[model samples]
Target: MDVVRRNNVTVTGNPDGPVVVLAHGFGCDQNMWRLTVPALAPDHRVVLFDYVGSGRAEPSAFSEERYASLDGYAQDVVEVCQALDLRDAVFVGHSVSAMIGVLAADAAPERIGALVMVAPSPRYIDDDAYRGGFTASDIDELLESLESNYLGWSAAMAPVIMGNADRPELGEELENSFCATDPEMARVFARTTFLSDSRDDLKKVRVPTLVLECNDDVIAPREVGAFVHDAIAGSTLVTLEATGHCPHLSAPAATNAAITEFLAALR
Candidate 1:
């Protein structure tokens, strides 16, 4: 119910069927999954919500220190699951939320039945052996860009997020999301997204999982997708031929079809 919003998120979905919790990534809110929800709602109970600072969540509820770490966001996921009494839930997370889902599922494995991670990265930064698909400098420039321009960074970042800055609407969409955030909170979110490393936690995931890889995704490169697939045991990997980082937007049908088939297989 509404009580779940106390810590983080604005939840929505069917109450009677099996729970399907859909989480969004950084710099965006649950609205990112709007297109994907309609397909899942009629058959399964669906849960769509914004993280503590993003989406329709009250701006006043966000905390810089509390949400500074991934655990804070993960805790919100756990709390919402507990409040709703959701068991054996299917968690569908995008980008950063996918990692958050991993952390939450690890914490409460008994409650989660399966995971569908879209554009997930266990560790974004590359190690000696692990190529997480990005370098320290890549993340540094991202943080710097976020700090300097903020709005302009989003405008520029949108094309990167959208994978098509040339597209006029991508610029506008990016502006709206960038401006919608609270400056301080946004800074903290950016820090969390770029800084946290969840590779260690991947081994802790005990439930059935699926990794949905987006081809030509800038945020989560194909290598990162391969890394996630290899790291998680007994997880299926599907490469989606979508251009933008947001597959649910750029290729909802493909995204939905993959998910629908996976859920059906579970049944």
Candidate 2:
């Protein structure tokens, strides 16, 4: 068995309750769930952490080639659960991390009791039957933006991450939270998030799952969320009437309520 040493894990809330591991999206890290922690803390034992390359993770672990696919990130999630000795945990993930959680849950279904996938996308690219919300040109443009001005693109994309561009201050704060990684590392992480497709793993998720989709998200739109719901057998899909890719920040109340309700139902 491979032992993955604990990286930058931020745990909070009840220590004795059922474990709830929260994973953040691309460009952002554990801090993105700050608003969510307070809500889940009173009842659930929440565990949050940065990927090996992002947030406050040990930068030495980041390798563009190694983490080029989703499996690399999934490995980190599995290692985290094993290191913490968490069992039957509720794995919550946002944006790209949502897909990571799915992959992790598939890898270790025994450890994960349920999956709360927020704004998850199994595949970002479009195929004949699937609409991943982003066109090939759109992704190319985003990659070009990353290449042109890494910092600027991060700033520009911050609103999309938080789902509120009118609040430039929020975007700035998100950009700061995501600024922990170097430009090269950020590029690597970005490529991994945007390129990998986890659609095939949806059918393999054995645990009970809930796919929460934001109302009007450009990144993972409603259709994609529905696709996930249909693909993942026995999983329920709920739409949060909020805009943006990061609902945990934009609509904490609704997000928390949905999570609470779902967890209660499982009990």
Candidate 3:
């Protein structure tokens, strides 16, 4: 299959500028990065794509077995980079896509040089000395609820994940995005996202990295942000004044500024 067609890849921005890939999180498509695209387009070649089973990606390309682990998503990133022949591209990944970027960079070091991890959490379930903000049973219950009724789970969880109750539209948009996804595919992605642990991957990131986190994200708390920063040597962590996991949607200006600043420093 043509990787671009399979992933619904969309490229924009300055043709002569450095390449920057914007990857969305679970239950989200490339549209989620609409607010941030213009900011980078002025000075960077921006690439956007929807993972299979999400957004307008070819549904037939989705395989539950392939997507049962985060490696599958990383493969999607690697293949997209190869299709574009991207060299040392800057990968900006949101939510679960952040870890996927880490994996992709490790898998194809020449394709990606730097990383911008937005609202990332290496592990969601808490362990002995770590606080991932959720217990094992919590994840189990959440997954069980989602498996039972994905739509209802989306409607109820989107608002919480968005974290801007004052602006209900953001939550509604996320809920709609979730609803638009194939439930069975979403379930697989959800299980894969919530159950996986990528803490060990942090130490392997040798490229320049910026870890962006929200001031109040229910999904990825401050502790997780600190852990990520401390784990990755020579990484910069910026706490946006935003209050949601999806800061690109909730606080685009701040998020874009931080990202653009990071890009500038690299040059």
Cα TM-score per model: 0.93, 0.94, 0.99
Error of 1 at 26 (Å): 0.5
User: What TM-score does prediction 2 earn?
Assistant: 0.94
Per-residue lDDT of model 2, residues 113-190, tens digit only: 899999999888898889998878888899889877888888788777677777677777778866656788778778
Give residue 112's error in model 1 in angstroms: 1.7
Best of the candidates, TM-score: 3
Give the TM-score ranking, best first. 3, 2, 1
lDDT of all predictions:
0.83, 0.84, 0.97
From the highest lDDT down, the ranking of the candidates is 3, 2, 1
Evaluated at residue 183, the lDDT of candidate 1 is: 69
Q: List where candidate 3 sits over 4 angstroms from the true fold.
A: none
The local distance difference test score of model 3 is 0.97
Which regions of candidate 2 deviate over 4 angstroms? Answer: 1-6
C-alpha lDDT of residue 89 in model 1 = 96
